[model samples]
Target: MNTNKKAMMSAPNTDQNILKEENNNRIIHKKTDTLVYALGGLGEIGKNMYCFEHENEILIVDAGVHFPEENLLGVDYVIPDFGYLVKNNHKRKILVITHGHEDHIGGIPFLLKSVDIEAIYAPRFAVALINKKLEERRMLRGVKIIEINEGSRIKMEHFTVGFFNTVHSIPDSLGLLITTPNGRVVETGDFKFDLTPVGTNADYQIMAYIGQIGVTLLMSDSTNSGVEDFSISEKKVANAILEITKKATGRLIVATFASNVHRVQQILESAVASGRKVIVFGRSMENVVQIGRKLGNIKIGEEHFITADQLSHTPANKVCIVCTGSQGEPLAALSRIASGTHRFIKLIPGDTVVFSSSPIPGNGQSVNQVVNKLFKAGANVLTKSILNNLHTTGHASQEEQKLMLQLIKPKYFMPVHGEYKMLVQHRDTAIETGVAPENIFTCANGDVLLMRDEKVYQSSMRIPADDIYVDGNDISGVSTAVLKDRKILSDNGLVSVIISIDSRESKILCKPVIVSRGFVFIKDSQSLLKEAELIVYNALKERMKTRTTFSEIKNTIRSTLEPFLYNKTHRNPIVIPVILNSKAAMLQMQQQRALKNSNHKAASE
Candidate 1:
């Protein structure tokens, strides 16, 4: 039961030859089993990627990125490690995307950076957003995104995937019905039972047809599984937002997810109905809106929408601003405005700031910080928690999950797209729907589920997986030591000891000079600096005879200063010893002292 055994132990293949071997042997010997690998999005809330492998052919679904936690300092985003896929990419036949949400499609650019994906299959609306993102990353070359509809059937080497309509906050969402050798797997891509949805109601007719076809496994969303009731409809939220916009006398500002096309549509309609000219901010929001309009996914009159440049000239009472960063993302439009850093937009006394989206689980602190900043900026802020009708969840609740379970009638169920607790809750719900307890799997990232002969079994084998952190254009593992050092420097400040060593002998040239930054100011704390210098000088004196290594000197300096600095100032500043030369400087003072003694002795004789 060595679950930690890595997958694809063989060497990696070149991009030119990876798919050659798989594509050449298209003759399918349908095995009686299907392997499901959860690359990400098991215990975590974001980064949603999965793999379905059968007959040595892999079909990847939803390559996505995860948002960094508070502790992941300087990280722009996090993604799946892709180690297994990199080693075994020859098995990949095609990559399919579920939707356009960041959690579902944000990692495409990064994946394309390394892996050579031939084609990407997505719906029309998702394709529009994906094209814009790909163009931004300059990754549109050599890539093809096939636009799919509800009835489109994609026949791969190991699976035949069929699409069905689902109700979501974003328009043109789809549910996947993948036919494999083991049976059929129904993948729910973020849905809610919204009969009166803002865009269109869930396609119950298509879903019932799939149910009649009989499903083998149900991989469902568990985001709101902890809530035991149904979530409010998006249409209700639109009406509520409309009412708020009508009552506001000054500029009404709304912040939400940029990919929420239906929400954006509702806001636009509300703006038009309330006789307010809409101004869209944030690059992502602008890009999505532009692409959506071009693709005919978002419809609005030309006069109803204006750019940010026109905000200054437009009357404040007649303006409605829709922007990104309801989650308090650092560089998003709402954050810039809340911090009073936006070049054009500023909150007036009568301005109303409405957050139409609730804060994500890990984003409470940042959202609160933004709200507090908005309050300090003299704007009236309204949140869903306080107003109750401002925001509605796009995920299926416990009741909806239960309903899906009953409708699909899956013999085996595995909860997807949520935390561990949510997954467990969903598993229990599946049990309540009469699915056998042993047939339900509440798995974590990298846990594999194998369905064989219409029976499902959870495997102990886990492939090596690591969090791939993206900081700008560079992709690396979550640099723990670097983040820890950064935290220390930020919290306690920094202290550096500059030691000039001679190239001749192994000794210090002069008194070790100490420079402090962010710690106690040099001008104010000379005594502390002097004492620190003495400590280093004494340590150097002890190592004067031996050829001390640079790392040795740095370690000695840091280990010596850390506890003392903490004890003295109640702060543990980052300590660095700058060894000027790679080798210890030759001791010039010893030669000078020896010459002085020889001169004295000669004079005395």
Candidate 2:
């Protein structure tokens, strides 16, 4: 949606208006059944937000954000439109978090600013991360975050929510089982079936018991559904990391996701096993490590750690650095080190850099650039490839997806978190596991599903699910038009033409001056620029003859110069016409002259 539409929908109204709208929604939604829809994370990966509504109570699952793509210039991230939640603010609203991953909790701060949430229920790790975020934004006041574990159960007015342990890359990960008046709904938050996990084992007993009880609908993660086999266990990756660390003859530097606490733990264990002192780099890495230690998730001792000042005194072969930037983000710690710009660390000969995480889907080129830089700097680089088994995904593959489906045995299956093709593949897997094709609903972001009397139905009505671009701190400032203009400016550049005119007599005061930036070389293209100036001068002269306004004069110049420049250079740069009022300039000059004369006379007297 455009910026105007976003502002109109999201702008805060008067108290009376808000109360009136809330009252109207309360009356309108009294007969509404169990409605399910997603604000984000359906057609794409990352930002995941799902809504479950029954009567006046709403249970929100995972307020997250999606990182911007390459084309989204100047945008930091994208969040789901909160129009629906804002409109139903009078209802009993509760947010439930699944994990501590950025995609699952990055949008919590923004969501809290938009909606007045009653309370947030999350696991201990996720709660710590959320509090950190809220504190950073100075929004920790008046917000309640209740910590819940596998055995915890929350009873609201319309739903009963419970958690089950799931095996992911991070510790304290969970899947949710929400019970409504209509039936039971299970949300498998980013999971895999790893028999030997690093943190916790998947609770198959609870999953099977829930299946035995019967679920009306199931929303499962579909990130890796296209892969044929099951995902590799984190334990296998830990062993691989240990092997690599033991074989290295020089200093070791490993890069991975900061939120992957299990992987970080393995890295530290490997460091201790190899008798190497550890140094953690990157702010996010430090925060996660500190939190993990405080929570007893990481068991590394303080004696194994060293500061940057001690790196030079310590032997090169005995130092291990764990950092962020496995995805090759330019500002990340590993990227700075690869570019030879890091303040404390520099790449030296015999230094082995291991990317302990796979490159995210759109970051292959960036990772390749970093690898090339490291190779040129006389450092050895190893990544996740067929020859090396340094990384394992946290998502479930096709077989594991089938296992989840068989265990849940949902009456209606809806795939939640992946791209379109991945969702379709998950639907096929569901079909293979005895779920009817008609019972599986592969929906887009805004499509709604209603469960009435234990039967799910697709609704014709929809809610606002458009992406709200976040540019810096302002939410509605960046629009599609703004992005289009930015693209044009980046591609074609800019040109400005300045002219002075006496508005009273409609007379031209001087020749038009032309300036170009990224459009053309002014010195080399003097002849072409001269022609363009002549065109602007003539257009203004002709337009002024008809008592034209400033806008008309500018339009005349643009219309006359654009085609001429295009025909000459075959480029369509943004052409701007600047007008100077000579009448005002003359009046200011007269005033200055009068003041000078009076001052001179007073000095002579």
Candidate 3:
């Protein structure tokens, strides 16, 4: 039956215009049902993965990765696990990428290493961007590249796919229209209805035609669904930035996302218009600008785009430096400049620093730290607080979402790209707009929604979705436990206890070493550290007679030491208990271990 179904699905469809009508008959007319699965972009935004199955062929959309939160220290990037795709790769046909945003394309390099995709369809700019990335990995050799323009149609047996222009920070962003045997689903990739966008805001006429053709489901971006009003256009921000650069006393340094070409263009144009020499800072920022300029998405005079050294020679007041590290990433140019760590440039009192990008969620503290450093260095800082109107979001707001919903008028609505609250709010918004509650589907990561004959049924399928942490060239998956640990360390301080325990019996061999971070300092509370060590030592002794496993000894030390130390020090630190197992002949070695633990704990505290 499976073989027969595969043969039938492998048969190509000749009718492209009447594809939807033919799809309805072929999809619903099947003996078996079809399932829709989410490989990414379910609970949290980014790493968007979705699959639609018809008979035997499956089409996957948007394999991407999310950026690591603030506490993921030393992590380079994150990607989704492709276990589901690998297990079912025989049925998977093509990966339809929506845009070139990090969240949408960041995982491609990592994903391709695992699952061999048949083909990839993306817009021109995204294709160029992705090809550069794949080439860097040496994975672009045999890959089939299909450049899809707005209104272009792709046929794969029972499914007919179409692309519509989407307005985002990147050029050539597109929305996907997957017309299956049963119905049509319009996946609105990250976009905003910017009437004055640098490029096109989603092709409405094509959507109107799709609406006439009839859409059963509309899986839309819900990142800003709960946000009120329309997204402010990039053109508006350019004028705002231009206004700020005109009155700058010292060098005007603007920090933003490297991938935000729209924002970069605005900053560059603002500088050029203000008669300021523009110097691009940061290696990553320079790379992006070079690519965008080559593709004609951005333009700057050869005289205008200069190096930091060139800017130093030019009058500081006549230079506008566009750089990276808007999130206050430690090694970013802005962060280094603020810290007085950069060799070429240091922010002076009269200098103007503009944070053109807003702080992403979880990066508030880091952003504030950078702002504080700039302020402390006597630089005149202009952040979101003062330069509130200096930047605008690329995501579509409530009004735009409502307009989109009103346009497509799908039978079923699935809200993608947000947390549970955002999804529920979006669902309710659709409900208020007359979309039936039954028609709105709010799903999480690893959920499978089956649509049969225009009716949707859902089941749970655990798709391996996780973060890939990279430092330098080394890449590894970060466990959930590591993220949790980071959250705890950032929120509360870390308290480490190094102890020398008996080889056979888990007894306190010496004064327990205690170290604490994000907690009370040893200089201020010397007595507190002494007390914490005693607490840890007593707990280790208490567990020595009862515990056998390493984990038990560690847990007992934590539970017993945490409360006692917290009560005494008035601060809670992450308690790490280390047990040193050794031989009786190694008394000096044991003492050294005990002494090392003691010193480590003292330093940590």
Candidate 4:
């Protein structure tokens, strides 16, 4: 019977058998699950990471790092955690870069060290910038880099991916469309729909085509979705800058984001039109000019890139200084110029300093300090607030967000590149465009989203999104906890209290030892310390009667000491309690008490 069955199977036509096998393979592939995961930059605004999983293989998008908050002292940068994909090493195929922003590409060096990447696809300028970082890290080995342009496509096993041009402040920003066997997913990598962009606008036709083809998933930028208007263009800001230059009589200084090549071009144009030579200052500004000019994104006359020595000799009216440090970085050229510490150039009376950038959140205090320094240097200063429209955001606003949602019309929407509230706002915006409520996904760093046949599933496999604290070139995996501690220490000050107690009887042994830092000067705050020690002594004796364990005693001390300290000092200092098992000093005090008692008894007899 078995032999007859084998013969019957073999009797089937060869072409028919082959066709059946192929169909089986196709059906198995079509039924397979597909997933999208983010390594970073999903919930938070900075560290950008995403993964597409199909047929057991994964394609990664945009490995990046997050800049620290103001209180994150000593932190170098935060990289997305890749621990979840550590076991799936073989499935890792390609690292596709979206743009040249630091948050989008900064973690490449750190990430490349872990994953065995097959090839890296990025735009030309982005590749160049990443190469510089890779070289600096000394880990550029065994990696194949492919420099791509807009409208380029790559076909891989069970997938086809293409890059479409998107307008951002940086050149060659692109969006990605990943086509699975069943559907296509559109990802907008930090974009603004600037129709009047310097060189190219958002690819309207490509977006329309995606809408027509029907995107299975749409992951778009939600960084600026909270504001209810269109993002102002660089052209509009250029006009405002030109007007400022026309009115200023003294030396004109413009401080902007170094990567804002379009804004830099506008400054140069306004400078030449105002009969001044643009003298580029600051290391970052100079590097940007050199790179952009080399790449043909920026066109500048040889006379424009003048040295600081030439700037010193030129009359104030003939010089237009373009520099960095708009965020008030202490080491930036603008800070040096403001403080009159620059080697060749300094701000003087009649000079004008225009800050052509908005104060990013958490940077307001530093920016204000820099503005005060500039004013003290006798230079008139103009910031976004004083000269409204002088600076516009690179991210899209509410109207453009609506336009993007309408154009892409994705099956599943993931709002990314924003804080929690911002992500929520973007989600609501997507809903207004008629996307089903269940189809919307609001993700955070490390969370994974799985898409199968246009249905999405979420799992909390949060990647190891961490901050690497760096001083100079050294790197360490010091978490944000360290930063939080520093902030607390800075704001509330620190207080250490020491009190000796009898371990067996739970009795006070000595007066509390109090030390204060950043709280109050010892001499000035003597009375406060005295009263605090009294409270600690009283609390310790009272709690010692009931509290048995050291930790309980510490907690009791903390509870009592914190309130007393707060009441007396009007500041809450971090309280630390030190308890000793044996109090030899207390024995000494007991011996003195006995001697005094004996003397009194003898004198009375």
Candidate 5:
């Protein structure tokens, strides 16, 4: 049997004998058991995608993208490989979005282009965000996005899905309760137990009700599992912002994540309370404010907004600027203003800049750099600290995780949406909540779990779950080879050897010219460059002695020069051999020489 055909046929309706035979011979087997696996978000922080399949129906939770680190070179976002979803596209597929955050819905456009999703179910806020993204990509047509809420319940062919409100940094976040044939599984998107939250509170009653009924498995967020105690309330951050605004005598600038709608709301309200007009900066911030207002999440009046051109007339003490770059991104609005490069806004004396968010895992150095620059420009900077509670995380801490475990009372547990250490910590927390150690599973991406007869077990089957890098508009263009080449160019630079050759006669037309960039200075390394040029000339000459093809000649030049250069400089720069046909060059030279001869004859006459 063909592997692809066998894999596709490994659905629910296959014969028992065939399944047994395939199970013995193949890595993947067809069974009626409920299948649980992750295409991403198992051992890492971002690119979250989880799947639950039973019979002919498949339920997907959260298609997200991971922002590449500084070392990923030119990659924008890292999405999950959609090979499994596309291969099993014959099944009825439904995608349920947890929230509007980029880590949850950023990969929706990419997912839509790869697989055939029956429909997408999201909350009101996420619907707006997704529609805006799709519209920008011109992919809004034929895409079905239905709005759901905490009270909404969806009944599919093999599952019944329900949602309950959960408090997070963003509004309209929900936890999902999916009932499959084997048992009920709960997925807490991203939540914390905030008593005095900025927006709606978590639905504890619904959570307890679901727990009372019974939960076979629970997959929860482990982002803050390592943090001690409960997470701080958003209302507290609001009060801190209010206090800062009341005391500041100059212009106030607040930097935060654009997706933190509640923070933006508090900033707007604080500005209004302090009798300050608001000026929003950054494209992402502007878009979020617009969407938040359109959805009634933000309730500021139109009169509160003032453009940059009006800044000259406005008093510094009466103006408030809200922008992005809480993470200290180089191109963000706040960073530009801090560096004195912004066209409309610059750091003035006595300006109070508040960082309304903490630095993400790998952004501490960048945030410090930006803060240093801001302070040097005669401005005061405030970040999240014990003295000033300016920012609060949306993830639940250890105590909150314990509370969730006690409430859900799941028989089996798997921690999701965090690193490996965090997941292990969450597992220990679950153990303390009376869950058996054997019932807990800490897995990596592509690992499979099967639940049959209310018993869960690990399966030997694995799927394709590799990181698919997105570069610009192309999804599949950035391969490992491309990234390797980019790293080499960034580290060692590039060296190009251009040679003009007469292909018809298999003869060299001119000496090879070597150009170096980021490698070594040509004027200072004259002897080295001359040696490299001679090496290329000799390789080309020797290869052309036997009517060698252009490809062989180029390969010979590259192979000879690479080892020679590396041995000489201890650097392995990208070696590029440019083989130019001498036909055009020879013709141009002849024309120039003839024109010069004609000019001399005319001068003599």
Candidate 6:
């Protein structure tokens, strides 16, 4: 018997497995032995994707991407492996997005292409952003995107999901409350407790009500678990920035993440209040502003925005530019200006460049390099460092995390969205807040937690949580060899040798041409290149008249040239030997072979 057939026969029909009747009407309920797993966003800060399953149905939350780590040489971003989602795509119905940040929605484009999704549910702002992404990929028509808001509830066949507002760096963020037959699980998307945020704050009353009803399980953000105090308010950051721009004598340039719409709003507010014209740069920042304004997430007057032509006409004192590169990304707008490469914006004396964001881990050196450039260009650089309260984090600190844990007071707690150490610290904080040691489970990506009849425990079955890289535009073509070659080029540079060879006789028909890029100077290293050409010529002579394959000839050249180049330069360059069978050379060899065959035929006759 086939294993699939046997498994199908044993599989339970969850649609009719569990149900209840209230007031003579049947409610869609199912007996859910739940399996909760994280394909990404565990044991790290970004790439947050989670799966909730009951029997044959699964609901996905927060498809995101991770920023490249230190060792991932040329990778732009890392997305979830998606193997689990692909395997269980039939079981998946809806994918719920928490917000519009790239980490939360970056992988949506890939997920839409990889799996069979029924629809995607997100807030209006997130919908607008995801629509922009899909439009870029020309995938808008094939996707079903549903715009949801607070107080909205989606009842699936097996579970019911409710969304409530949560304050974060961006607007339209929501926390999910999922109800199943066994228990209720609340997932608070990345958040902080800001009594007075720029937009909407967390619904304390609703959270308290959920706590009163007794939540069975709770998953909370652990990004700021290691911090001891509460995060500074976004309102405070706005106030400080407003004052900073008000005192600018010349041009004021504020750098921040484009996705932080609230921060951009504040920057605009400051620019307006300071009576300065706002000129936005960077393609990413321009797109965010365009979408935010259209979606009503950001409101700014048209007169406040000026173009490059208008910028030159305005007084320097009345100019304010909001750009990218707060994290010191090389190609971002602010970095270009700092390096004197920007076309429109040029840094001059008395210009104040404010970094309105914090540097992500592993990006401090890059940020420092940008700052050094800004100083060298005679601009005054301002950052959270050496400044009092310029930027604030969006994640909850230890005190705020405790408050959330105390307010929810769930029977079981699992920390999401942080490194391993941060997750452990969150678990300890939960224990201090009266959660049971066994109930507070700390798991990494792909670790499965099973819940049945109000009991949750670690299960042996796990999902695939390996991550894939998105290098440039193509995702699948970036294999290990591609990355290895990239690292070799970046580290040691490359050298190429082009040789015209006689294919029939396996002999060199001309002098070898040696070209080097980022390896050695041709004019200064002429002697070295001459030596390399001679070495390659000798190797080809060794294989002359033999049935030498291209691989053997190339390897022989590599074996002879690698040591010579290394001994001369004390550096290893990637040697590439190109054996071009020239048209003339191959034609001559063919003619010789034909003549030999004709002479043999004549002798036989």
**Which one is best on lDDT?**
5
What is the lDDT for 304 in model 4?
A: 63
* Model 4 poorest 10 in a row by lDDT: 20-29
Q: What 10-residue stretch in candidate 1 is worst by lDDT? A: 2-11
Per-residue accuracy of model 1 over 342-444 as CA lDDT, tens digit each: 9889888889999998888778999999999999988999999754688788899889998888778888899999989989988888888899997788888
- Report the lDDT tens digits of candidate 6 across residue range 184-290: 99999988998779999799888888899999999999999989988888989999999989898999999999989899989998999999999999888999899
TM-score of each: 0.88, 0.91, 0.77, 0.77, 0.92, 0.87
lDDT against the true structure, each candidate: 0.83, 0.90, 0.78, 0.80, 0.91, 0.87
> Per-residue CA lDDT of candidate 3, range 475-548, in tens?
45666677677677777779888877774555666888777777777788788788767766676666677746
Give candidate 2's TM-score. Answer: 0.91
lDDT tens readout by residue for model 2, 1-605:
96645654685784322322332232122274788999999989988999999988999999999999989988998999888898999999999999989889998888888798999999999998999989988999999999999999999999999999999988889999999888899999999999988888999999999999999999999999889998888888999999989888999999999988999999999999999999999999999999999999999989999999999889988999999989989999999999999999999999999999887889999999999999999998998888867989999999999999999999999998999999999999999999999888999988988777787777666888999889987766489988987787888888998999887677788889999999888889999999889888887887778676778888888899899989998889898889898868679768899999999999999
Q: Candidate 4's residue-wise lDDT over 332-425, tens digit each?
A: 9988887789887867899999999988888889889989999988999998864477898889888999999999888778898888888899
Ranked by TM-score, top first? 5, 2, 1, 6, 3, 4
After superposition, candidate 3 runs with Cα above 4 Å error: 1-31, 71-78, 376-378, 384-388, 460-476, 480-605
For model 5, where is the 10-residue window of minimal lDDT? 14-23
TM-score of 6: 0.87
Question: Which pairs of residues clash in candidate 1, taking residues 3 or more apart in a chain or in different chains?
Answer: 502-585, 502-586, 504-586, 505-586, 505-587
| Off by more than 4 A, model 6 | 1-32, 69-71, 385-387, 510-512, 567-570, 582-605
Kindly list the per-residue Cα lDDT of model 5 for residues 1-605, writing each as its tens digit.
88855765765663322333453454343466899999889888888999999988889999999999999999999999999999998999999999999999999999999899999999999999999999999999999899999999999978999999999999899999999888999999999999998898899999999999999999999999899999888989999999999899999999999999999999999999999999999999999999999989999999999998998799999999999999989999999998999989978889999999999999999999999999999999999988988999999999999999999999999999999999999999999999999899999999988876666776778888999999987777489999999999999999999998886688898999999999998889999999999988987888888787767987898799999999999999999989888767568768899999999999999
Q: Model 6, 604: alpha-carbon shift in Å?
A: 32
